[model samples]
Target: MKKIVIAPDKFKGSLSGIEFCNAVERGIKKQIENVTIVKLPLADGGDGTVDALKFYTGGKLIAAAVHDPLLRPIQARYLYAENEMLAFIEMAEASGVRLLKNNELNPLETSTYGTGELILDAINRGAKHILLGIGGSATNDAGMGMACALGFRFFDAENNLLEGRGKDLNRLTTIDTSMVNTELRNIKFEVACDVDNPLFGPKGAAPVYAPQKGATKRVVEELDAGLRNFNEKVETQFGKNLQNIAGAGAAGGLGAGCVLFLNAELKSGTELIKSIANFDEQVKDADWIVTGEGKFDEQTFSGKVIKGVLDSRTNQQLAVFCGLSELTAEQIAAHKIDYLAEIIQQASGVEDSIKNAGKYLEEAAAQFAANGIVSK
Candidate 1:
C-alpha cells in the first residue's frame, strides 16, 4: 500500500481544516485504491487554530463568556488536550474583527480583554503550555485590555484608570504590573504568528493594519500616535520598550502583550504547523504533494503553508500543484510550482466560488492523482 498524507490549512470562511483533509482524502481515494491516508489538518495562527489541534488531539472544548473586540459580551471556546496538558486558544475567536458590525469597526475603541479571559480560563484548567494563535484581531490597543484582564493596570496622565481603545493609550503614563496573576509566571506560552511587523512605527500595528478594521485616515493617525505613546510609557515605567520587536504587531500588539506580560515565546505560525503535522516524516515517502490556499501569489512564497511543504521535501523534482483563486504563469514559475489551477476562474461570483470550492478542490485533486501515474 502506498502512503499518502493529506495535509492542508483551513480554506478560511469555507471549510475547516479537518473538512479540507476529508475532501482531499475522498478525491485521492477515488483514484488510488489501497492507499494509506494520513489527515494532518493545518492552521496559520488564525481562526482555525483550535480546530486544527482539536482534530489531532481529540481535545475537549471549554466555552466561556468573554468580551468581543468591541467590548460586547460573547461566548468563545478554548481546547484542552488532556494528554499533553496543553490548551489551544485562537485570539480571533474572542477579539476579532468579524465579530463587529460595520459601525462598530473602531480600532481605537476595541479591546483584547476577551482574549485575556480565555487565557485565564485555560490557566485555571491546569494547562501547562498554552498555544495562542495571534491573528485576525480588530483592535490596536497594544493589548492593554488583555493585560488588564490578566491583572495589569494602565494609568493615564492623572493616574486614573485608562479605559477603551488604542487612542486612549496616548494618555497612558504608567503600567502597573503588581496585580498580575503570579500563577501565570510558571506557565509556558507559544505564540503562533507569521508577520514580524514591530509594535509602533511605519510598519507597526496601527499604521499597517488599522485601515483594514475600518479606521479612517485620521483614525489611523490617532491610533498610531497612541501606540507610540503607549510604547514610550511602557519603557519609562517597565524599563522595556517593545517597539521594533518582531511579531510585536501581530493581533494588533497582542503578540507584544504576550511577550511582555505573559512571557511567551513567539514562533512562526507556518513553522509551528509544520512541526506539529510531522511534515518531514509524512513527505519522506510521498510520491507527490498538492497544497494551496485561497490565493497563490508572491505572498505564498513568504513562509506560508505551501512554502513549508516545499521546504520539507528533499526531492526538488517532486511533483507539486497549487490550487488558488487566480494565478499568473510568471508567479507560478517564480515559485517553481509545477502546475496551477484556478478554482475561482470557473465560478460565477465570489459567493458561488466559495460555495463550490470543495467540489472544485476534489476535481483538482483527482486530476493531480491521475497525472502522477502518467508522468511516472
Candidate 2:
C-alpha cells in the first residue's frame, strides 16, 4: 500500500494541525484505494506547541492557576511527559496578546510573572528538562516579571522592590538572585525561538514588536530604552552581553531571560518540534507529504513549518495545502514544491474560506488527490 504523511501547522484562529490532518484524511480517503495515511499534527513553538507535544508524547496536562499578562489571576496549563520528565510550556498560555483587551494591550503594563510561575510549578513537579515556547507575548519587560516570580528580585537604586514591568526596567538598578528556586539550578532549558531580532535596537523587541502589542511610538522609544538598560544590567549581573544576541528579543526578552536565568539553549522553534516528533525517522518511507500553515508568505520560507519540513528531506513528492498560497511559481520551483493546494481556490471569499476552513481544506485535498498529487 502507498503511504502518505499528512502534516500541517495550525491555521491560526481556525483549524488546528490535527483538524487539518483529519480533514485532509476525510477527503483523500474518498479518492484513494489501499493507501496508508499518517497524521502528524505539528507546531512551531507558538500557541499550539503544548498541544502538539502532548499529542506526540502522550503527556498529561497539568492545570495551574497563574496570572495573565496583565497580572490578573487566570488559569493556565502545561504538559508534563512522565517518561522523559520533560515539561512543554507555551509562554503564551500565561502572557499572550490574545488575553488582553484592545484597551488593555499596553506592553509597558503587561508582565510575564505568570509564565515564571508555571516554570516554577513544573520544576517543583520534578520536571528535569524544559522546552519553553516563547511566542505571542504582550509585554516588553525584558522578562523581569518572570524573574521576579522565580525569586529573582529586581530593585531600584534605593534597594526597594519595584514592580517588574516595561516602564520599570529603566529604573532597575540591580538583579538579585539569592532567593531563586533551588530546583532551578539542576534543570535544563531549551528555548524555542525563530526570530533573529536583537534584544534592543531598531529591529529589537520593543521597537519592532511593542507597537503591535499596543505601545505608541513614544512608548516604543521608551520601551526600547528600557530594554537597552535591562541588557546592560543583565550583562553586569551575568557577565554576558545579550544586547545583540539573535532571538534574544523574543517574548519581551524572555528568550534572554531563559538564557541568563535558566541557562537555556536557544533553538529554532520548528526544528525543535521536528526533533521531538522524530519526523525524519518516522516518515522515512512515506510516498508523499502534505503540509501547510495559515498563510505561506516570504517568512514561511525563512523559519516556519513549511521550510522546516522541506529541510528535513529532499526529493520527495511534497505539496502544501494552505488557506492562501502567496508563493510565486519561481519561489515554489526554487523550493522544489510539487504542488500548491489552496483552500481559497475552492472557497468564494477569504472570510468565507476561513469561516468554513474544514470544508474547504477537505475539498482542496480531494482535488489535489483527484489530480494524483498525493496518490502518485
Tens-digit per-residue lDDT, 216-332, candidate 2: 999999888988888888778778898767899988888887888888899998888888888898679987889989888888878888888988765568878888978899989
Candidate 2 Cα errors over 4 Å, as ranges: 373-376
Model 1, which residues run further than 4 Å from truth?
A: 316-325, 339-360
Clashing pairs in 2: none
* Candidate 1 pairs with clashing backbones: 108-165
Local distance difference test, each candidate: 0.77, 0.87
RMSD of each: 2.8, 2.3
Best TM-score among the predictions, by candidate number? 2
Question: Per-residue CA lDDT of candidate 1, range 1-376, in tens?
Answer: 6666666667777877677777777777788886777777777766677787777678999999998987789999888998888898888888888888888898888999998999999888888888888788888887888888889888877889976457677888888878999989889898998889998778988789999998998988888888788778778777778885789887778778888888898897777767776778877876556565766666766767777776776653333333453546676676666656666666676777688778877776676667753345
C-alpha-based local distance difference test score of model 1:
0.77
Whole-model lDDT, model 2: 0.87
